[model samples]
Target: MSILYVLLTTFGVIFLESFLVALGNLRFLFLLNVSLFNKINWKHLLSLSVLSSLILDVIYHYVLGTNLLMVAVPLLIMMGISLAVPLENSLPGYSVKFVCIFLYYLFVAFVPNLILTGQGTVITGVMLGGMVLKAAISVLFCVAFDIVWSRLRKKEEGTKLRSL
Candidate 1:
């Protein structure tokens, strides 16, 4: 059931990102899910990341390996953070999530634009602003999910206690 949950959310992110213009190539949804939800095992998260990036690449018509490289770097960083740092529904955790999402935007949007357009390229205000907005939105969404999940867990615990 947890595997199914992970797969659904990961693929749902990929689907929205691939088809929706507003998503703007940012994988924050997936990043936040994997970072916050320890239920997703490492192996499944890794495979899903690789698969999603490839699918995004094909959908967006990028060079085959570009998305994989961009997506993998931040994913590894997030995985390390999730493992080493005890992130919960707190300020530090939220800050880390925002930073990770920002870095993901940098890698997915800025770096590729830099590489493709060469050193003479400028990142433009619109792109940077969009990244910030997306990151903020992702953080907010994570917080909301945490609240709902906590409520559900509490209700379940209460029910178990009553049964006892």
Candidate 2:
């Protein structure tokens, strides 16, 4: 259809999806069933993601250009990976998501700029070190968020059981 329309739409979705993923990343519960993470609340995630993105789109739009591809594409890929390589709690799954997210951000930092601008990349020890530093920071934030959410969830569950 319209490239401009798709551009804006995708840009908006990029913003919204990032926000939603931030919320999801903060999610600490359902840690056991990582395989069904999307399937279980896919509807809720989809609706909320759209709404948040649309609202933000109405605000100010960032000129992301082809970087917009980073929005949903990797998520779909990760979902596929999760589905194909089902990470059972009896096995291990959380770290898989962590690695995926880390790699996704790493791509966001270097890949888009290289692809869109056609500037070849120079991979150096320092650059890799910086990426690792940033990724580790993200892990810290996610773990902190998870801890808070987990405690809150447990507290709520405890109250519910008491009421029963």
Candidate 3:
């Protein structure tokens, strides 16, 4: 929940994508996991997300303007959706949050690269398959993180109750 932790996690994802060959492409899943299930304020999260995207754009030699657009569009869509559907801490709420974050990651990961490389707007079979796999992996990891964090929180609360 701390800003330091948030920034470190963002940089960790960057490091993973930049340095690790086998896990490089999993940054999307990692970022989505952090973003969807954190206690950070939306404003802080938005700013940090943009900052991370800028760092990533420079590191990847991305086109100057595309990264900002890629960051903003999905975030704005998420913001709009959040207004329509409040984010509660229940199963259906988690489902909505996951769906929004899933779409956000897909757009951020796929669309800008396509534009930057001048690839025409065509979603090929391989690309679609990759998207599905990424979604599955993201879902798996997010759920795991949720479970672990919930248990940790409960244990922490239990300790507090005993001390009282």
Candidate 4:
């Protein structure tokens, strides 16, 4: 995809999350993972991912040091994983990609915040049950995306078969 489209999609998703989820920033990590799995060159995807994160940091006005770490850490992990797995092939399937992407989103979203901002408040009695509410928005949207992507993929396959 063109860089402009990539950037627009990334920002659109980010805006959608911020508007809908009220600080839920899973979209960046989600897009980073998806773009990498598009079977494009890892270097290009990595650059775009980092650039997107940097743009986010700018928007949020995060401190220079922590902001840099926030972007760099995930990029490092992505590099490590790509090194171990063959990049020439796309991710095995959407389910596998979703799981990995979800886990990576957790790490990317929470860990750095913990490090830079310190451990958050205890999940005292009542708060413990609210975890589902916290996650439901992102998960539901992901399921919606899965439906859309799968339909698009099927259509693409049909067209390719017709062409053949």
Best candidate (score: TM-score):
1
lDDT string, candidate 1, 98-144, tens digits: 87777777776656655566643456789889889878877887888
Evaluated at residue 43, the lDDT of candidate 4 is 59
**Model 2 — which ten-residue stretch has the worst lDDT?**
26-35
- Model 1 residue 69 distance off true place after TM-score fit, in angstroms: 2.5
TM-score of 3: 0.64
lDDT of 3 by residue, 26-92 (tens): 5452345344433435666666666666777787678665555665665566567667776444565
TM-scores for all candidates: the values are: 0.69, 0.49, 0.64, 0.51
Model 3 pairs in collision: none
Error of 4 at 35 (Å): 9.3
Model 4 residue 112 distance off true place after TM-score fit, in angstroms = 4.0
Sequence-dependent TM-score of model 4: 0.51
Best-first order by lDDT: 1, 3, 4, 2
Deviation (Å) of 102 in candidate 2:
2.6
RMSD of 4: 6.1
| lDDT tens digits, residue span 17-125, model 2 | 4564476432111111222244324544444344433444344242343333443555566677777676433123445555655565566556655765777567678
Evaluate residue 147 in candidate 3 and report its C-alpha lDDT on the 0 to 100 scale.
Answer: 64
